[model samples]
Target: MSIDRRRFLCRGAALSAGLLLAPGWRAWAQSAPMLDPAARQARAVRYVEQASAAQDDPAYRAGRRCANCDFFSAGQRCSLFPEHRVSPDGWCMSWTSE
Candidate 1:
């Protein structure tokens, strides 16, 4: 029957609610893994197609992949985009490719 009054009250209520929710945003902020950035970066596959020529190259053919590596975040796919996401067929120097 009276739309103007209800609309004004609703807007005021929403504004107050949003203002109250603002300070609480910190609680919703995503927490990082326990591992440091260096450790996280280690999982990011940067070099995939080549092998190191060093006398003792750590890169191997088996058990080495972006998915199997510890550096790879659990439930996470590729370390490259972290979002584009890829499979373990994946390999890279960053491959922790465990």
Candidate 2:
């Protein structure tokens, strides 16, 4: 059996659209491994799992946290740390308001 080019292209486009529109697909794609505070990247950003724990640092502000940062997304993902997720309550020197 042989398939026509037009039919094949249409099917491929449909499949691609279906996957993009599927529920939870975005969440699954965004989810990444949790960030380790002791990792080199985390250290460079001074990331702390608990915002309050960063109180000793001059950059620490009273209510700043990952959950409220511009770089944070669903599933604790942080754009600054692409490979890992940061705690919602985490604080980092790179944090920016949403």
Clash count list over all predictions:
3, 0
- How far out, in Å, is residue 94 in model 2? 0.6
lDDT at position 26, candidate 2: 65
Query: How do all models score by TM-score?
Result: 0.32, 0.72
Best by lDDT: 2
lDDT of 2 by residue, 1-98 (tens): 89999999999999999987776756664566789999998999999999999999999899999999999987778899878888999999998984
Compared with the true structure, the alpha-carbon lDDT of candidate 1 equals 0.49
Deviation from native of the Cα of residue 74 in model 1, angstroms: 5.3
Predictions in order: lDDT: 0.49, 0.89
Report the number of the highest-TM-score candidate: 2
TM-score for model 2? 0.72
lDDT of 1 by residue, 29-90 (tens): 22323222234453453434223322143655555655676655444444454533334345
Error of 1 at 73 (Å): 3.8
